[model samples]
Target: MIGQGCLEQDDLSSSINIMECPNVISINMSASTSPISVSWEEPTAMTTDGKRIAIFNQSHSPGTSFPVNSNTIVTYVFDDISVCSFNIVINVKQVISSPDACECEPNFTFLNCPLNITSDQPAFCGTVPVNWTEPTVIDGCGGSSSVEKTHEPGSEFPAGVTTVTYTFTDSFGNQSICEFDVIVPVVAVEDDSVPPVVSNCPAHIYEVLEPSQTSLIITWDPPTARDDSGLPVSLHQTHSPGDQFTAGGYELVQYTFTDAAGNEAVCEFAVTVYPNGVNIDTQPPTVPPTVYCPAVSYTPPIITVYVENEATSADYNFTWPTGATDNDGVTPTVIASHQEGIQSFPIGFHRTAIFYYDTSGNRKDCYQNILVRRQGSAPTPATVINCPQNVYLEIPEGTSTRVCWEEPVVTDDAGNPIAATLWQRRLHSGAEFFINGNCNEQFVGNTFYDYYGNVIRCGFSVTIRAIGHENLPGQWTQWYNRDRPGGNCDCDTTPSTACSNGEEPIDVQCETLAGDDWLTVGLIPSAPEKRGQVAYCCPRIGFYCWNRWNALYGQQCLDYRVRFKCPLQ
Candidate 1:
């Protein structure tokens, strides 16, 4: 054999000792390449069993790197002329996976929180599908995939109120939850024919703007609508509260509300703003408030004067304005064609025209119709008393008597004499009347005065009579008086008038129509009040002789009130 040919088994063909390999070795790879050392037991050959080999050789020794895919190790041994060699296999540990650290922190905030959503139910009653934006969350330690949510986007939801909750956890197991509602109506609404009811709708709004202001900011409660059906409603307006309004004629603001069933209701109002020193007097004035006469009695021609500077309290309800006002902060000049208190207005209607004028000659005309009414009650008829009864006088023979009495007095309920005018209206305020059928010598019944006129009757009576004296004997004497009362009395002294049926004449004899029977005994020249006038056939009838007296200046007698002397029957 040559010097390196000792590994060849040509001479040791007969002693064939198999070369054994070391068991497969395994080593893990590290950050750096670290070698692993391997060893193997030498096999015995025909030459000296386990004796030391004359030549030992190995492909890799200790301190040799054995990495993955590189695990072969061979060893060769030769004892004298016999030798054996084998290979060793090594396995390096591979990294299948790596463990991460635990993270838990409650100190996390949500970048976005979901808001409550409202949606109408489907026309056909059923569950409705709803969608919402996902909430954004920020946590230093975690983000599993997205955020933890109870319901996903575009999820089916039953009608009625439903709460959706979102939960979050941090590295240290700290958990927090954010929730919102997914409201959906369970019952579908019917087709609505009626409109929504609007409330708090404003009337025409009027405001005065300052001279320096170009626009006025008007604030009012927004109109609200209630759906006839129990469903939600939406409102849209042309203007909102606190919006600016310029001065023109009328700036109309309209509001529309729509219900779930596609029914709509509208509310509209005008905002009229006028600049200073300008007036918007368009309509006619209404009827003024009713006024009453304060007099206790019915008095005609009441005069009421309205003071120019007097300010009446204007707590009226949109009727005729109590007084005029100016937007320029000045008392306006008032021009009224109708007189308030000066004119004698009956308890009825009176028309008035009012004009409001500024210093700049800007005028606004208005008309008001006033009404007058009576107040209190009318006084009752006046009370009259102290009327004399029927008078009877028995004067001595051939004498007259004076008839005098207290007049009737008038008084009120309080015993106080009422005004003369009041007495005139009810009591006998006119002249006293004496009613006799014809012109004759007689004292009529009494004094009678009508109430305010002769037409109405109201009076007391006064009567006077005389007694005749007996001249000789067999003459029971009594005075007979027929003052303007016609027919014949037989001069018989009786309390009542005794009329002689046709069998008696007037007074002298109850036989013929001519003689002393019709001749009256005495005459009262003046008012028949003087006593001791000439009686007992002394002269003639001093008043209206009427061809019966036959003497000088007898026919010149005026009206006569005669009483005759008669014999007691």
Candidate 2:
């Protein structure tokens, strides 16, 4: 056995045929020893004698042949020498496992469809492990394929794309159906649709004094809706912020804005207007002066004139000096008047005055000043001219009273004693000293006044006593009063006679003077047994001594108002 390496022992090898089909046979030998001596032929045709080997169909050649060089040996001999030849057979028909095809990968798209059928295709075939077989609609000829077939072999489609048509039946009856398109690539159906957000922005403030008509200003900037990350907004009206206002008046007013997505901006401000009516001038004119009547027996002088109207909106009208004729318009009897004044007026004094115009215009006026002596005629003696007649009294409060008389010999209207015209102190209290008065002891004493307010002397008696260094020498009173108001000689009904000795004397009548009355001094502590200088403590004039001096003179105690060291327990 060489070239094709063929050897058959007991004639059972190549192309398998053993003893008339009862055994095997295979032989091919040729190493080239002798031309006719390398042979072997043993098919003498004996079917059942020794063991059966009659398999000779001419030369036995059906299909396989390839055995040339390399010592090709081709010899086959098997007359009737078969023992156990091969033979076995068992055939069945339907066997199929090869027609597989399900392609649904051509780009499908379906996220929220009519219902649902999944097939997203993204598993690239490693060697065919894909299957789906629940699609059986091949009824009659293939007409019920509206898409409801799925064979479940790795089926996962929920994105849209399907084409699986597999119909197979192999093992000889032979049948096949195939289509591949299980591809799915559209996985973006997670839409939420959201887009909008903008809160608040737009305003204006104004105040510029005065004058205005139209000052361009109206604003906005807030809108951007559709929010889901803490969203709560909804508005749609072209997102307003533009109507158009150009430039008007009074300087300082600016604006420009937009929102709702157009986004724009600008801002500025100021506007004012103010000022109105005021005018005034008050009339005043009229002057006449010149008169010397030193002889109607010599004495008479009185004249006054005034007119006015200034305004703060009192609106005015006033006229004076009527119808004149001194040069003789012939009706020359000029007379005019006006009145109204009193805001306690006394700055230039004028209570309305213009006294005199006659010629038939008749007149008789007087707004102040007029006195022409000689009516009952008789009064010419009041010459105590210089000063100091006698007056010094102080008992205004416990322990203080002085009056040292005898210094009133000052005279000059030709009575001779005018030593340098001295002394002046006037006291008249009843308006509770409404202002300047701190000469202590309410000092309304030390008197004298004469420059037409004649008093020439009413104080000069000197003698006051009440001394208590630290506390308690306070209480004394005397010099209550005597009689020295005297008679006042006159001049022209006294015309206030220049205060004629401080006037207050009408028809004459006088009385009273018996040890003067006002003397009170006290220091009592539960009556230390009638403590010192005891001047009748619990008696003399009952009512409890006038109610203990009426609680020690508290209620204006007889109009004296005196309190001396009386404040203690």
Candidate 3:
């Protein structure tokens, strides 16, 4: 038996085959109250004799085994003795927790929401009240009583644009906002009122000579009126005030008044200018018996004068005949129908008639005859036969010089002697005088007064003439020098020698004499000095003397040295 056992052992040992150990196995099971059943296929092995398989825990502890189809712990090791080992493992997967299902939908909505409103209304002169509708909000959760809104309904809004906001909030805090605009447009308004009330029309009557007759000044107070809207009233007239109307009968005028509302009212009045019965006297007065003459200096014989009647019943007016002269210097008078005061006639034979007129335009005239003898030959101009030479006299201030000179002989064309009636002298100082047939007269000495001082020289000339004789008019003789002898001449009585070449030289000299104390100083070489005098000088040499040396003597004298000598007075 031992030998047979040994041969089997050698055959098992030589036939021993190590199979691949089964991989680690896992078993899955749900979490439960009971233990899990673990299961795995066992690994096969080859040996000379029958092999045995055993299972143990990983610690190799004895008695730690697991049944193939029993509920137990799966972590175990299986081994074929002297061949290979296998492992088994169990994995537990618990059930996954899931969230609870939700089915809630929260939202917001706008309920009875106000829409944009546009309004067109007439413009109010004053402030206008505003109105609007409020917006309501509806939430999907419930009612929208908790919604917030801005600009409440029926609130006053200005005439322009306005905005309204509505905000809705749901129970879940979701929000919905709605907005709209309200516009109030402006519109024009019309006004209709009655026309203005006009009154105060006038009726005028005027006479011929009045301004209303010629330029008919048709004037009346401006019409007074009222307007419903308190607007100003405008007035217009067919003819303005101060407008002239022609001489005529009755006339009509109109005035129109208007108000701001375009209403008008008109008023009418009448004007009249009376016709003038008195006619204008257009016919001029009549004159008869005109005269003629060949010479301008011949005297004529005077004749009686009278006026003839030409008007019947009208009042009469008579005027003396113009252009009539008398050699005796007597003025003629004209009465109702007679003329008197006839003595001598003018050189020319002038026959003039009296002019007569009546209120009714009738006229008549009277006649006069004046016959003048015509001379056979023309008269000759007067000649200066024995005129004195230019004389120089130094009359003192407040003194005078006897202006002595030989009278010039004069004759007519017929060799008849002519009488000298008048003599004229024009001084270098622009003073002129007419001496009545006197060649020897007292010449009062004077001084030139100017703006600067008293420094002027003067000279004069003399001429003769036959008065009332046109043919015997005298000619101017040579000029003579006027000297202030011994500085003696009555300064107060002497005329001023202020010379000017302009109008009325003598008058200007007299006017400048004011405030002059007979010794008012003046500029040297005055206007008279510039005009070349013959040794002439101012008589007085005092505090106001311009040139110290007297031009008459060519020597200077002190105030004490100057003497006053009256030669002619």
Candidate 4:
């Protein structure tokens, strides 16, 4: 076997060595109700032969440990070969644990903290109700029940701002506080009273011409009414003063005046109308003397005379002699001879009489003498011949035609050509146009127009007459019918040289002037059952140049198209 010294040299050198001391330990801890554990690194040493070794506390285990308030010593020993060993004294210390801080701040939620109330408790005539808001507190530690309020929440207070405080203590005994305010105000009331007054009420009377008059107008001074409250008072009328009333009697008219307060007053009057009486007349009239004169020429002279009734009443009618004048101012109820026109009279002392009658049927007569003597031989009469009979002609559409005839052959009883004033010719349809000539003369009728521009024909007539020495018109002739060709008479379809170029060919359509197409062309078909295109040429002269050509042609073509006749050339 080997000696003990030799065995130690082999094992001790590899297992043990002088150890190093651990660093002073320091610990910080929080004061908590639960248990806390602590730990550290063990001391270590190295052998002379380059081997590492561990050291452990001889008095304590390396597992669980507790912190202390003061510094404490722990001894650690390192053994090598069980004969050579060393101790490491570690100084472990503890820092006092700090109590937990209450980090939560107190907060209060006032439902309606800033509240308003009236001093009258219930303002607006008790229309407003009492009101307030409750206060709530919140804390971080969840101990809201520990909160205290200086005043009870939702409690009514006097009219003014009132401050309240809320305090909260958390589980850690940390305290916080919050404050809020409530407010109240004052208000006043309003009053309304008083009524209106009426004034200027008066009465009146009205009279009408006849009792048979049903519509009577009664006017008066309009009354005045006012309200004391400065408000406008409305004036109402059941019956207006100037309204209609019953006939043949007197009636009381009433007017009522009212104020805004429903107060009313009335005034009234009477309306009277008299009855109409029967009217009659029984008077005779006096007649003036008649002036006499000799028959001078074939033309009769005019005579004027006056008559009056002794009673000064114009209530009679009169009958005058032939060729005597009658005044337009004479009425059936009044008789008075004012003036007269005597167209013709015989060549002798002729007695003419005038009779008169009153409205009562009484009658009287007055007589006068007119001495008419022959002046000279009467002038000879005139004669006419060769007046136009009938004429027929064709005029272009929208054009006028002239009708002329050879002068008629005329002569007097002396076989000489009649003077220019002795003869006349007349053309008549619904009206008359006259041509005068004493000697041989020519006549032309007024220009006639075919306004419709149609191709139809129409007729008219003319006549001739002669004047006698007595200025009497005599020659009467039968109507002569003249035929006139209507519009289409001058229409030509061939295009003119000016119409060949320069302007593009517009699509030609056979349509009414109203733009209603009734014809067809190629793919573009018009309304059913119509004709082909109508060629129209626009006259671009003067005023016609500025006008739209299509519109002008359309209007003109409509008439012709409707008549189944093309107006375009």
Top-TM-score structure, candidate number: 1
Which candidate do you rate higher for TM-score, 2 or 3? 3
Candidate 3 has its poorest 10 consecutive residues by lDDT at 502-511
Regions more than 4 Å wrong, model 1: 1-140, 143-162, 171-180, 186-190, 226-232, 280-569
- Go through the candidates in order and give each one's C-alpha lDDT: 0.41, 0.25, 0.34, 0.32
**Residue by residue across 372-487, what tens digits does model 2's lDDT show?**
12223112322443222222232333432222222334354557543222232222111011111111122222222222222332321122222321243323222122212222
lDDT of 3 by residue, 387-494 (tens): 233343333333322234333334444545543222122221211122332211222232221111112222222222223222222332222212322343212222
RMSD of 4: 55.6
Best by lDDT: 1
The order by descending TM-score is: 1, 3, 4, 2
lDDT-wise, the better of 1 and 4 is 1
Better by TM-score, candidate 3 or 1: 1
Scanning candidate 2 in windows of ten residues, the lowest lDDT window is 536-545
Q: Which one wins by TM-score: 1 or 4? A: 1
Give the RMSD in angstroms, all C-alphas superposed, for model 2: 61.3
